[model samples]
Target: MGGVNTVNGMTGIIMLVLWALAFGATAFALIHALRQRSDAFTAVDKLTKPIWSGILAVALLLLLLSFGGLGLLAFISIIATGIYLADVRPKVDEVQRGPRW
Candidate 1:
């Protein structure tokens, strides 16, 4: 029926939005990490690495689970972004900070 089709369409749109959000979060994290240039930022990144890694791992797992479900690549991309955010960014921040005060 027309109503059924409409519902399905809405569901698809919702899924797409969720996927985009996940990807966006990852990208934002990466950018922030790359741009960070402060001791406080570095400290926060160090403190949050493990937690971020765990979050990224879970995100990756969900993405894998979504292989044939919805937005799998988006999920993966986000995971990659999270990796940069959690792992690479902290190191970069530390380097930028240079020697301790």
Candidate 2:
């Protein structure tokens, strides 16, 4: 029983960390998407600015309602956030800032 409680506690902590990270990441992506020029996304050949903004907004909303658990909604939210950060962000930044030599 004590071991089970310990395991549950650890799981709870992990879930909380995941939840915070997901929320923060989604928020950051949304803010970044909003800050960039709409043309930058087009220049990068990515989704339109409004579409990305809407996606990140929905991801953030899902994260907020995930109850600190890594449910399907949370998983989807994290995936969307990851895509924005990993794939879209770099290309958008490059379009705005130019390539690094």
lDDT of each: 0.60, 0.92
What is candidate 2's CA lDDT for residue 22?
84
**lDDT (tens digit, per residue) of candidate 1 on 3-93:** 9999999888888677666655654664464345545444554545445445555565565556434565555657576666666675766
Segments in model 2 whose C-alpha atoms lie over 4 Å from true places: none
Residue by residue across 1-101, what tens digits does model 2's lDDT show?
Answer: 89999999999999899799889888999999999999999998899999999999999888878878989999999999999999999999988898789
Steric clash pairs (candidate 2) = none
Q: What's the lDDT for residue 1 in model 1?
A: 97
Best by the TM-score measure: 2
Off by over 4 Å in 1: 37-69, 82-101
The stretch of ten residues in a row with the least summed lDDT in candidate 1 is 33-42
All candidates: CA RMSD in angstroms? 7.2, 0.9
Clashes of 2: 0
